[model samples]
Target: MARNSGRVGDLPPPPEPLAVPAVDAHCHLDLMDASVDEAIAAALAVGITRMVTVGIDLPTSRWQAEIAAAHPEVRAAVAIHPNEAAAGVDEATFEALTALARADGVVAVGETGLDYYRTPPEQHAAQQESFRRHIAIAKDTGRALMIHDREAHEDTLRILAEEGAPERVVFHAFSGDAEMAKVCADAGYVMSFAGNVTFKNAEALREAAAVAPQDLLLVETDAPYLTPVPWRGRPGGPYLVPLTLRLLAQTRGTAVDEFAAAIAANAERTFGPW
Candidate 1:
């Protein structure tokens, strides 16, 4: 049978100016069900020139690295996520992830950290242990630590400080409350907001976006998941980044174009150049 071609559904109108350089800081492009080529084509059609594909486990981490290797516009972040970390990452898995981190195009070590929300108490200890191991790898390799903190703010912050994470730590899909936001901001960590910030009940998130230090702010779609408002019904991609960008810009009281430029530059600083 001839292969089906192109993405389904109407493509969102391309961003104006047609040359904006946008970086999607977090996405599970590998898990999108669609072909990576199709996703890339769709993203490019909407002005996303670069993306960071994140991994949640050993096999997926390796796949992320492979995706980065295949696509010049893509980079990888490898680690066992907090929910998956409960299985207790084996030594071999740690070594494999560390090796992938050292590989070219692997920019960070994570989507790793505490997620007490869904993790059962029986496996919480193992999750913390796994988090420490990933932190150590980040410290040793000097790769940025991409953290995923969900309903475990204090523990996450404590472990991050205790482990002495590197200067380039990033809190992917950061959902911390005001005080927690202050803690991360004080520590100079990057807080990446996603579509969650655009949700109707996300006033706190919007507030966090407002007070996040200018240089420390970043944006992501966390695509195929937290599709931002205005594009919530649409399939997620780097192309929809502008929707989130516009929301953030409005919340931060900055021009959309100016904020877009800053986010692009911030992404480059955090994940390195595309």
Candidate 2:
């Protein structure tokens, strides 16, 4: 229930660095006010050496591609978010997004799936069309697919199976129970945990995290949103990933150092090397 005000000025300071370096599986550097270099440097100083900056639309997707191309520590994921999917994609925009997906340093095609929470029922068809196109693009380009499923789990999973999921499919900011976790695990999908898992009311998410296979488990900030506990509601960036990561480690009953290493390995497997 923590909402993002999108106000970055008053965010909390970064916590101490983790014992093992980690990659923020997902984030949006273009949404923040800080320069890309500054954000990368700040995260690197805290042992967050790498991150994937995602794009929700054509323009932002282009921005992410450019930034990732220039920065060694960054990668990009491009797609139109499910909420935006209802807007209907024009042929021109689809062409542009397709080009960006094949661009250098673009590691995935996603943050695209179904979101019934904020999107109206009238637009469900459009969302489904967009999701299908993204799935095809991911498969065509042979890149990972980062999915954003909200309140449309069954439909999302159905479409993924129907369209044939890409080799690497990640449920970013996974919002599901242990049952759903098993379904995704059985399908060889990655369940990425965001800061919301730290909330008191998110027992189901924690259970999902606990059941997630170590090799298939991933962590993300999804910033500047889903800022971890005590810092929830404040703007966040990759530097804040350790907070959620520590919680994930505890939920998995593994030492932070060991778990962090495993998460790093999982990132490599999902998005390709660094």
Candidate 3:
């Protein structure tokens, strides 16, 4: 992922901490400029007590597990991202990815699913095959299934149904509408909204947030990307999570502290205790 060209000025000033502890259920800590110890301190200072760093490929996924092993405050989710899968993820690739998914401190197999937005029609089959393989890996490991569903919701959902979704499933940076939210809610899939939910043009996403069951809601920065509003275009870090959490709380008409607590609990359930 590319960072803003604005240098240090591109990093947003940290928002006032939530005071109540919360977890950034999904993020790419390795993608950010900060070291793990530095990022953890910044997040701790802001009451973002725990973070789940996600990996988009094998090497990064292994790094995720290594960092998680070293830092009690961090956990990891590993998978070949949808776009990468579209490029052609062979069984050998999945074999290695599967081994990583079962590693210690690695709580989920994910950020894997269909992405029609960037991938062209010709590669759709490859993407779907990789998604199914990841689904199997998640189930096999008895870990949560982290999904990256973008403009391919119907197929994403269909694949899950056909593949028999693992007991736990999360739609990272969930991009669906209220109807899709309902489908996810009814199917017991967790929707982890990223900073993009704060955008003014995201009324439909806001609607989904408003109607989503509180228990099923989680929050993330997807940092180094989707940096939340007021800090839009700024390079994001875990420390900036308060901005998005506050926005999500307000959107749901919930108290900030209470909402934060719920998200923390949801994170624990989804990724296990941090």
Candidate 4:
């Protein structure tokens, strides 16, 4: 994964901490400008104390595991992302990725669902195949399945059902509207919202947020991508989670502290003891 370019006006000072600490259900610390320790410290300072650093490829997956192993606050989710899976990646590499998924402190096998948005039509087969493989790994290892569903919502859901989704399935940076939220809610999938849920124009997402069961809701930064409103287009970090969590809380009409606590509990349920 490419690191965020710390261009002028990109990295902003950390926002005020949340009233109570909350977990960042998904993130990509390896893709940010901060080192693992630096990112962890910054996040901890803001009550974003625990996070799952996701992998988009084998090397980064291994790096994610390494960071998780070294830091109690960080857990890892390893997988070859849908876009990367479409690239001529070999089976041996997937075997290696599966090994990484099973490593100590590796809580999930994911960010691997379907992405019709960026991948070409010709490569959809490859992406779906890789997704199935990741599903198997998640099930076999008894780890949560972290999904990255973009425009391929139907196929993503279909494939999960076809393969018998792992007991713990997370829709990382969930991009669905209320209808899809209903489907996920009925299927018992955790919908992890990122900063985009705060956009003024994202009423649909906010509606979906409201539809999600409180126990099934989660939060993330997806930094340095989806930086929340007021700081949109700026590079994001875990410390900025309060902005998104507050927005989610407001959308759900819950107190910020209570919402944060629910998210923390949901985090443990989805990813296990991290």
Candidate 5:
């Protein structure tokens, strides 16, 4: 899962630091190449003051909590990612995640939801069941829900409705068009765009960004994956958030500082004060 393979190299030199600080709404510190401390420092230098590191499995969930516990600038989001759900979430895994959901500095339960892209039809049922349980966990703990919807937008929205979403819901690396963005807009869900939104072929994603209400806007690295354009194939970290943020502001015809301030506020509203 680590693109940097456990060693931090020269990441694309960071883009210009935003005048107003922002938060990396979704990140995977555990899977990244940099040491946790290095990642935090790099992000801070670029005005990405806080990060919510999400987990995709039991071991990684525990690591998320631990990282949050050790760093003031980091918050933790715990869940079994939908892809990981294919293997099934047994009792022990569920119980541990529930407990982690209530841990201090644990601000969310997610990187959950559905991912039909890589999963097969036989496992769709399992992913859905796991997603439902995660929704309940988020509600029970009164934490935000971070969803990872990948090529399963319809089912993801449906399950959220059936199970009832938490007070705060964020679609991490939101991969939807303007129409889907409207649906999320109407639902008052936060849509966190990532570096991929800057890709030349991601017109639909850009359209979604253009139409999304400022209050619903958020940005992340989803690193170390989907590194922003001009630096796409490079291993990424929280520090690269500025590239995506600037592009989103430009697409929406909004001032960079104003856009940056709004997104920072949204992150606080969705994940609480970091």
Candidate 6:
């Protein structure tokens, strides 16, 4: 018996059952350390049956399309991120992204928009131009537009209005004040909340979430990034979506089950069933 005391490798645990029907409206699964297959499997185990993998550049956009092609549950959103726009996106990059947007399983045309935090004023014009191009692509291709706005809400809103953005526009990881939320709501835009809504100083965010129209609300992990509280200090993935959903449900004064159902319906409406 003493001779058999050495530790044996632990058997892998069974996959957790999917909780509420959840769709990670935005995440960089392709950029994670895990292989695409493993990431999809993990996401499925957690009930994250669907995901939209976004591209920050031409190469990544191509990769996103490839992931979509291989995985039935994954969809692609092709665009040039604002920061990458500053480094000088070429016409060919736009062309390539446009082609990808039209590809099967490509659900949206962004993760694009303005980001003043990393882009300089000198390059603001280019960023805006790139954004307009993406909006046009969304319109022409009939794909939903996922906008990434940070510290550039005014310009972001202004441009979308001016460019005649498609009917399906989402403000991914919405980081705006109540006023901005009101503006978006007025425009009939969808606001997708990330884990940031669960932060201590996110009173405004919670308020925004509470007031958001029922049909327009969405939840996402933005994983490997803004992990929600309870799991805030840890690495994130589709598995943690329930934590965010619970917080969102609490903020909205609705049952978690109801909120989850609404979000799944919203995702289906915006990106279509996978």
TM-score of each: 0.92, 0.96, 0.96, 0.96, 0.97, 0.91
lDDT of each: 0.82, 0.90, 0.89, 0.89, 0.92, 0.82
Error of 5 at 165 (Å): 1.3
lDDT winner among the candidates? 5
**How many residue pairs clash in each candidate at the backbone level?**
0, 0, 0, 0, 0, 0
How does model 4 fare in lDDT? 0.89
Q: Which is better, 2 or 3, measured by lDDT?
A: 2
Per-candidate RMSD, Å:
3.2, 2.7, 1.9, 1.5, 1.8, 6.8
lDDT of 5 by residue, 191-262 (tens): 999999999999999999999999998999999888998988888999999999999999999999999999
Worst 10 residues of 4 by lDDT: 1-10
Question: What does candidate 2's lDDT look like per residue over 1-274, in tens digits?
Answer: 1234466557678788987999999999986546778778889988899999999998788889989999999999999998888979888888888888998899999889999999999999999999999999999998899999999999999999899999999999999999999999999999999999999899999999999899999999998888889888788889888899999989888999999899899999998895
- Residue lDDT tens for model 1, 1-274: 0122233454445444324667789988865636788777777776677889899898888888888998998999999999998868789888888888998889999989988889888888999999999999987877889999998888888887787878799999989766677888899899999988999989999988888886888888887677777655455666677778778889989887778788889988988887
- lDDT (C-alpha) at residue 112 in model 6: 90
User: In candidate 4, residue 154 scores what lDDT?
Assistant: 92
What count of clashes does model 2 give? Answer: 0
TM-score quality measure for candidate 3: 0.96
Which pairs of residues have clashing backbones in candidate 4?
Answer: none
lDDT of 3 at 160: 98
Q: Which residue runs of candidate 1 sit more than 4 Å off their true CA positions?
A: 1-19
State the local distance difference test value for candidate 3.
0.89
Error of 2 at 34 (Å): 2.2
Task: In model 5, state the lDDT of residue 12.
Answer: 87
**What clash count does candidate 3 reach?**
0
Worst 10 residues of 2 by lDDT: 1-10
Higher lDDT: candidate 1 or 3?
3
